[model samples]
Target: MQTIDMTEFQSIDLRIGTIVRAEDFAKTKKPAYKIWVDLGDLGIKKSSAQITFHYRPEELIGKQVLCVCNFAPKQIADFMSEVLVTGFSDIEGHIVLATGDKPIPNGAKLH
Candidate 1:
């Protein structure tokens, strides 16, 4: 695996946000969801995440999640994804969302 310096990791804008809206990304070739997260001062940002294996649209709403907010927007199908929702693969290879242990203010940067 490649390694990056602490500075590089710190440069990534990893922040906590609350999922305000979620819906199926029907236009995507793979099953996915288009989520809108409310990032406090940052406002709402959209993301396209392929997490259908473990998450449902209704279950995602109001959930707090971690996101990498500084990346450039990506175009998937007809939607433009604004942030990268961070997650890890479970033992079964399903995507498990990255989140804080407790509730925190939105837009709180991960230190």
Candidate 2:
């Protein structure tokens, strides 16, 4: 794995956001969801997340998740993904969302 210094780590804009909407991305080559997150001060951002294996659309709403906000928007299929929904792969290869145990203010940066 590539290592990064604290300065580089700090440069990444990792913040908390609440999932406000989710839907299957019908046009994507891979199974994925087109999700919208409410990032408080940062406003709502859209992401193409490959989390359908472990998450259902109904269950994702209102869930607070971590996101990488500084990355440039990426295009997936016909959609423009504005942010990255960060997560880890489970033992079974399903994506498990990265989230805080306790509720924090939306758009709060990771320290």
Candidate 3:
């Protein structure tokens, strides 16, 4: 693995946000969800998350999750994804969302 200095790690704008809305994204080649995250002062941001294999749209609401908020917006299909909802791959390759163990305020930095 490549080791990085603290500055490199600090440069990543990682934050926690609550999932306020989620819907099926049908226009994409792979199954994904169009999700809106409420990032407190940052306001609500849009994202396209490929978590359909392990999660349903309705179940995602109110879920607190980690996100990479500083990345440039990406256009996937017709959706312009703002923040990147972070997750890890399971043994079967399905994604499992990275979340806090307990409830936290929205837009909390991962320090």
Candidate 4:
């Protein structure tokens, strides 16, 4: 497997954020949700997640999730996604979110 140096790893800004809002994203080819995350000092950011298999829009609110915060904004259909909600694929290839075991301050860095 390819490995990255410490600096390269550090360059990836991974942080915890709370999901403030979520809604159905109808304009995309695949099923996804348009979500808003409260990142504390970083302010609220938008993301598109294809996690419909395991989550619902209402259930996502107030959920703390790990996010890749430094990526450039990506345009998905009609949405501008500003952060990446990190997750691991389950044995069935469905995504399960990466999250903290307990609640912590938003915008907390993953070290």
The C-alpha lDDT values of all candidates are: 0.96, 0.96, 0.97, 0.98
**Residue lDDT tens for model 2, 1-111:** 999999999999999999999999999988999999999999999999999999999999999999999999999999999999999999998899999999999999999
Assess candidate 2 and give its TM-score to the true structure. 0.96
Instruction: Flag the better candidate by TM-score, 2 or 4.
Output: 4
Candidate number with the higher lDDT (2 or 4): 4
Model 2, residue pairs in steric clash:
none
Once fitted onto the true fold, the runs of candidate 3 whose alpha carbons sit more than 4 angstroms away are: none
Each prediction's total of clashing residue pairs, residues at least 3 apart in sequence or on different chains, is 0, 0, 0, 0
Please provide, for model 3 over 1-111, each residue's C-alpha lDDT reduced to its tens digit, 9 standing for 90 to 100. 999999999999999999999999999998999999999999999999999999999999999999999999999999999999999999999999999999999999999
**Predicted candidate 1 versus true structure: per-residue lDDT over 1-111, tens digit per residue:** 999999999999999999999999999988999999999999999999999999999999989999999999999999999999999999998899998889999999999
What value does the lDDT take at residue 36 in candidate 4?
A: 99
With a 3 Å backbone cut-off (N, CA, C), the pairs that clash in candidate 4 are none
